[model samples]
Target chain A: MSPLSITSRTLAAALGGYGLASLSAMALAVTLPMARDQAVIIGIMVALLLCSGAAIWAFSARSAWRAWAGILAPGVLLGGLYLWGLPA
Target chain B: MNKSFRQSMAWLHTWTGLLLGWLLVAIFITGTSAYFREEITLWMQPEVHDSTLQPGTIDMALAALNAKAPDARSWDISLPGPRQTAAELRWQPAKPPEDGRRHRGEQILMDADSGEVVAPRATRGGNFFYRFHFELYGIDRLWARLLVCLATMFMLIAIISGVITHKKIFKDFFTFRPGKGQRSWLDAHNATAVLALPYHFMITYSGLLLFMTLIMPWGIDAAYENDRRSFFSEVFSRGEDAAQPGSPGEMVAIGPLIEQTETRFGKPVERIQITNPNRDNAQITLRVNRDPAVTDRQRGGDPTQVFQGNTGELIDTHIPANDPVSPGWRIYNFFTSVHMTRFADPLTRWLFFLFGVAGSAMTVTGMLLWVSKRTQQLRRDQQPDRALKMVNGLNMASITGLMLAIAAYFLANRLLPVTLAAREDREIQVFFIVWLVSLVHGLLRPNRHGWIEQVAAASLLWFAIPVVNIFTTASHLFTPLAWQHAAIASFDLVCLILAALGGHTLWRLQRKPLPAKARRAPAPRPFNTTNPASEQPAGESP
Candidate 1:
């Protein structure tokens, strides 16, 4: 792929990592049996570390498509699981 | 996309670090100084140095607050603790209509013993450095926090990338060889970066967490339904509100309760906050010193105890039980304590401060190495590049210029007339003005000479501050009067040590001409050797 395509992919991965982090954090808050406040705290901590890891994965990938897959696949999976667990 | 992982990481590291390195330097320097924020505040207000926390100091502080703000709904009394000598008081004036929005009210600095106001020199003191470390002055706090947080995140990225890119990071930690141009700069940067790598990581990450709610509100924003106060109250385990009785009751004396709290905590009570004073259901909250040591436990012991104002009966408390407190809150305080270091003693605080200085040094050296590398390449090609010149000026300005500005700020604090209007703001203005002038000076002058002048200027200013203090105030390095006020004396002594260090820096800069590598290093691209002198700019110093 061209440099421009690569740059775009990198940017997406960065934002995607942040998005995944926020989603997973929200999921933790909803799922933890402890008080809502405590859940929020634990969730945010986990999310911060996850975001950092995701950032590294984004840059280290061999291709832009792979980076996108790395961030989005887990994000969608976790987010979907969170939604499924919620009362309809 | 085909580039190796280390190569790509190097690209990321270089750009992210270059973009925010200057801001990081300033932030690290000021934040490190803030380890002694209260002591700096005290030293600036020299009149309070002789005062000590007397028995019943809390009662005197409460009485002072009562007499001053009788109609106040609540009072915040930061009583003379182990770290502070003045009882810093703030009140919620009954005059301002409560709209659930906070506003600054009357603030007073009183002697905890005498219960009289200590009319010290009006200055922002070290608080200027402390606040500017995170929320820059004269700007909207949200905007400032956002900007700092962005820089912090970038810093985090750079640190991670930096570690990844340097394959021999541990091996390089022991490396240092001065005066080798880009080589020396790289070694210095690596040494500082790798030496206190853990500290650098902890300080950066915890700093971001301390301002987490301010910056990353999404988690709480969702969980608490956007009500910030409710979110905070829940996270902190807010106590139940006491219902007010219609009729007033005779209040129990506060002196004994304060003594009881002191004994209970094995530490002196720092403050006694009275809410709804003189009301039938008034409540008194006593706070003791935060334990001054780092522990691995998830739960921290809160030092606050609440009591019924009328009966002196303990109503609510957050002090940790013998069993570990709530695990979640423990994690929260663990992060908070690491960043704030309220638990650390002077020795530990100094260790943290020195690591912070090393981190700042790492940033400066990294930036200079970038400039030096480009300059050498540009020189070998016999190209006079405008961008190189611009980077040179900025390099001189951001690092040494910042030092000069801080010294000038201390100088201004001492030299400004005692009764000048808006005195504190004026001191801060002088700080910025000097800093701006240094940038302009850096751009216009020859880079090498410009660096020398700024370092010399910084040294002179640092040396002058204590001398100025000797004349303007009672403290001096050798004076008997200074011995009585150890904090003030040590402050002056530290000033002297910094001055000597600055002098040594000035000497080093003068001893070294530009690292003599451009002439000898292999030229990346050949250029005319016939007119090397023409490449030199006019008005160049000998």
Candidate 2:
């Protein structure tokens, strides 16, 4: 593997993956119809698993750009969901 | 990413497993030791070794507390249990000094039988290891927790990728080939990892969950409008009585209350909390030893009974098993409780300890496999590069060096003067100092000779602990008191077991390792025809 490719993938796995997980957690916490504490807990639990899955996706993609695309695409979707679900 | 999905996973596993393998090994070792932290603390305090269980222990402790802190606001008596030899007495004075300062409380150790106070040497005991396993020592708590969280994340990814990469995990569980150098290391790693697969997965996942608030707080922030404290108080709701003390009156005997609670729970009383002592409104709360179920919350789940101290009448009873919990919280409790293993009996605790050993072995063998694979790839007469040598040095230090440091820590506890100023901090200093020395030694000599010498040194240190205990403490291995106190005896036995393991490692190392020429080389692979069932290459590049 090229140095630049490895470095980019590593960044995507670490930073982008974290961003995606956070957005998902926020989205689930706000949107899920349950007790606030239970929703928060389920959100955190799912977020942790998604974080690891993000790492796997970051490494498994065909190219560095694809790695960033895979993480960021869902991240943007989750971010939008989070804002839309926020209490008015 | 590589040509195939499995190849990519193998690559991911190799890097993730190697990058933080050192920290994971240390965490596993120390965290595993935390299973017996109370026992370890008891063993370290030899002064209380002679305090065996007695039927009158509770009365003795209460009598002593009554004499010592008669006018205190509250008294807490922790009764002796299977792992404990002394009853702990703590009291909060009714009034603090006029000056504005935090008066925490006063506490003393009382022998179970005589109720006489005993002063154990001032040492951190097992708490040092228990704390170091997570937040680490001398660093900012938040930063240390974050660092450990990052490692745990990496461990989770490594576990997932490792499972994907090992195509024959089930088959490999039954296969162990010794005397084959790199292949043997790989086999041992696979065996340990696959054997305790559920434990490895649970431990890594729960480790991340333990710090969810610090690492993944977005959920709580979004749900509660950034009010974390309210969230915690809501989840762990407790009923705190705010009753004022009544007129002074004679209180009823405590023995019957204890017996009544024990009969109700079918478990011995673990602790007694008395408020408004010697008053008409005095309330005694008895918490029995935890009888934990798989889904029970770790804290606040003990079977407890409350009594009217003056009348000796039952006021309230709480059976934690009957508490209603949502499925989400139940799942969370199950994972966290299993990870902590606080509910385990002696046999279950020992089983968890052995599983922890297996986890440590998995990480240690993985590190060795990395080095062995790279070392085998080197052609004859080709010296190892600087980076390779550095990695080897770190591997040795994090493994053998850590063992040496722990031994030195125990030795320091015994060797230091009991009255020495800041004795606890001094003992910790000895641990870090020895660890630093081992790192330096590993860097100076990261070869066969270095490995042999360090392992030998660590083995001798482990062997020396029981010998040194004879000269330093009354709870030596040969003493009847040590036998009576199973904690102390088991502590010595574990040390000898460790020393024997080290000796076995040393003995195996003495047998000359296979030459580098005989091991497999990292060459371009041809399609495997003989093993048509498995098409994966024998060696994959990092």
Candidate 3:
């Protein structure tokens, strides 16, 4: 659409990619022993989902907020969990 | 984004990648090798033939240490196990009063049986390789680390910008067109970078964080009041807090302590440090850890226990998984774990090794891309541009010449006398001298010829390593292989394979036809004529 929107979309996608990676890593870290493996598998799955979501948002979203939402949702969730639930 | 922003980023990505690519390749190569530093040490020392340690060897080793280094402030004894040869004792004397310079500790290599000092060897063991990646020889460690840090930051930027620049990122995910010069280099770079994107990101970011104290020291320095030891202890869970040393008392038997450590951890005691050993407040810290392994992540969840030196009583315990550390600290640990791969099994180590090679390939291709892209412009310009030529020379020297230097270092390890004074330092000296020599060779030769020559030299050196080992060592590849000795033979074989690849590369370079377009002389300019009749007459004659 508009150049501003496209730039916002690109930034959103970049953030989304970073969010996916961080969340996947954090999820794997918090889960203990046997559940850790399962957590990592889930994390990988989630990361892929987020990555695909970002791609779709880049192409399809008419509004910049929607593109940003695709990334921010995962980023905020991951950051919150890491700060609050991290093992001592 | 505006075209200027995109263009600026593109320029940033290109130059940053080009400038740092060679250093990055060195880093990846050394880092990967550092994963097998212990194995390399084992290969270097043929005198300690087998992995097994003699019974009561550690006790005897300690007796020697007590006798030789009684005045020393602290003694660290590393017990011989599967990965190392000889029980080694290191003791650092107090700083001298006049100059206040600390002496580099005395290292006594004890015989496994008699516990007498063996002929001193100069090899710095496997740890040197680990140290080489961050603390490059001849450079201050702080400066080297900073350089590495800058390189890593640029690398991260390049990775991010590269992804942004790739228009068909997913569509060309698996594409690799083999022989189309510049296009092929781009394809190779993209494939390597994309396929291992996770590895690339983790490695680059973790590498940067590896020196985070240097990069972002405000938190750690402010918190610890700039006390590095305290910071380390708090972060790494090192050194127990104990009461002041009491009067000298009878020390307890270390055998039971060793047995206790082994039994508790299901791993052999790697090292034992007795703090204030002569006093009643003596504390024995038994370091029982898993044999270092190579994996995607190096340090795994393992516990380190400390016990009282005299009573064999438990003092304190540090388990990385259970330690109360900040998220930043844990993140740092996670990066180290990934970088060192100490927790990995053999199969996983192989995976990391392959990835390390892929990382090296990414750097090499990036450098090659610089030259490949500029070749067209240089050809179009009748005369060879000096700046482009210099860039071409530097790319060749760094990419191929560094490999030759490393090969030369391996050769020097074999050639250098073991009994020579400061032998370890000498070996390291050889490494730098050879590297410097390669830089000179690169600068002096024609750019294209330099690559061929350096690659050929590297190939020869790699080929020679096994033959030299066979001549010098008792264990050769033909001998029945054991787990402890397999690394030595395998390393040699890997060198040979590298040599073969280098040879093939050199051969291909030799065979490349000179550019047909570049070879043609520039079209002669027609003589200027003011007379219109003359110009028409020329056209008519033609």
Candidate 4:
């Protein structure tokens, strides 16, 4: 793939991941406050840190797969946290 | 200097910008208006005009509050001063055992002298615009905030890539060559982006940081274990817990407290918070700080001091200039100040306003750049491709459509039935609905027609705003001008001028017919050009 396409895809993926992390973090912040649930809040915070790291990596990395993985990890992890740990 | 890198950056700039250009337009418009939030509030409420400034002591205000709301849990009084006409009072009723959210509160606008509630109407004043930028109406606030963050991210990339794409950033700093098609658009985008680079950077970064809790709450969550009050107190040194009463007795008079607060702060008291006003545990916390010049210097830092309720003792004072707290605090304050323009003098505010206009222009020109480049390419290829056509349509809707939607918001503010459910929200609904309608219209119409029609419609709506205000309400340009409310009057005139500018733009674009050469196929060279008889005279070719 062309460098431009790679960069665009990487940026889009990073944004998608950041979106999920932010949504999960927000859910935790709101729901945790009401439920007095600390564990879920911590879980979301850990997911956010991972997402921030992925964004940084995606921004700096040259390899396409590495950039894609860097961008995708946060979204996948947040999804897992929401599905398993969070109440519907 | 690398051609490929430049090409890649150009591609990055174009797409990144296009993806978020409409959102950025809304942010720029709303953000710019937010600078004049107080002025807008002044304009909205015509009933409270130039009231007498109250000189009564804080003790008198506290006495009034105690009499009015004896059983209230917390009472807040905004002292009547120069900028504000009425002494505003707020108090929370006893919270029910069921939920904290059901606590009843009242915002009383007092007669500066008698301290009686007068002209009490629930109206979203200038604060609406200020809050609207981050918290868009209808949708979840978190969603709106997240969208703004995403836009800011795209904006940062666009600005960086835009600088790299510009070959003559310095040389074309002041250059503006109108009627030069793509060159003019590029020059416009470059000039605005470069001239206000610092403003753009500071505003976008600060906007992100303003909601840093939402964006990056991990640090606060981990450190304070997600306890909001503790997190705020630790970072701001606010000291959340109030002092317990030493001995249960009648509270001391607020007049002496006011005197002590004024003597210590050397500024007029702006607000006073009373805890347990009627009870023996009552404490009046007088906040003395309201010099915009000095407060602006503090950036986003709280420049006020809190005093003990009973003894009038100093509790806590925050002087942002005296010491640097945390790096986070300083950064947060700097950005917040930039966003709020609280530090801005009139001239500086105007400069920020002008730069805001330039920022809006940059987004419009960027969209135009895409359309202009694609049109040129399609003309060269001798066919209008489907992708190019769709882009052209989107450019029309995104640019002019946004202007129309903003105008629609103003119109809705005036025309919507006052009794409508969630009236303030209805104005925002009109804004989005109008914009969506324009988008759908653009999709249906021919690209050329869409541009002309949407711009014309926007111009009309914009021009109609002041006229509507004049007819619908007592506050018009004439009255405000007569009263020497320059801020309010000038705001209306500025809108008119913008409308006129939009009209002129639409007129020019509509007048220029599509070039015939752009539509027709290129002529083939004569086959028998080498034969002298067959070849016509150079200028006489059929």
**Candidate No. with top DockQ:** 2
Write model 4 residue lDDT over B311-426, tens digit each, in one string.
66666676545654444334445567777776677778888888888888888777777766554443232555666666666766667787798788777766766567777667
Each candidate's B-chain TM-score, in sequence, is 0.87, 0.92, 0.82, 0.82
Candidate 3, residue B264: how far the Cα is off, in Å: 3.3
Q: Model 2 off-target regions past 4 Å?
A: B96-104, B241-247, B513-542
Q: Could you give the candidate ranking by TM-score, starting with the highest?
A: 2, 1, 4, 3
Off by over 4 Å in 4: A1-88, B1-3, B50-52, B56-67, B80-84, B96-99, B102-104, B111-129, B218-232, B243-264, B290-324, B380-383, B417-421, B480-485, B510-518, B521-542
TM-score of chain B of 3: 0.82
Q: How many clashing pairs does model 1 include?
A: 1
Model 3, span B70-179: residue lDDT tens? 54556788887645667878876533245554555567677676777776456875576677777766678888888887677667767776776676777676788665
Report the C-alpha lDDT of model 2 over B124-205, residue by residue, as the tens digit.
Answer: 8999999999989999999999989999999999989999898989998888867666777888999999999999999989
- What are the per-residue Cα lDDT tens digits for candidate 1 across B329-374? 5776677687788677778887887888898888888888777666
* Highest TM-score model number: 2
Q: Is the docking of candidate 3 incorrect, acceptable, medium or high quality?
A: incorrect
RMSD of 1: 4.4
DockQ per candidate: 0.54, 0.74, 0.04, 0.07
Candidate 2 vs. truth: CA RMSD?
A: 4.4
Whichever of 3 and 4 has more TM-score, that candidate is 4
TM-score of each: 0.88, 0.93, 0.74, 0.76
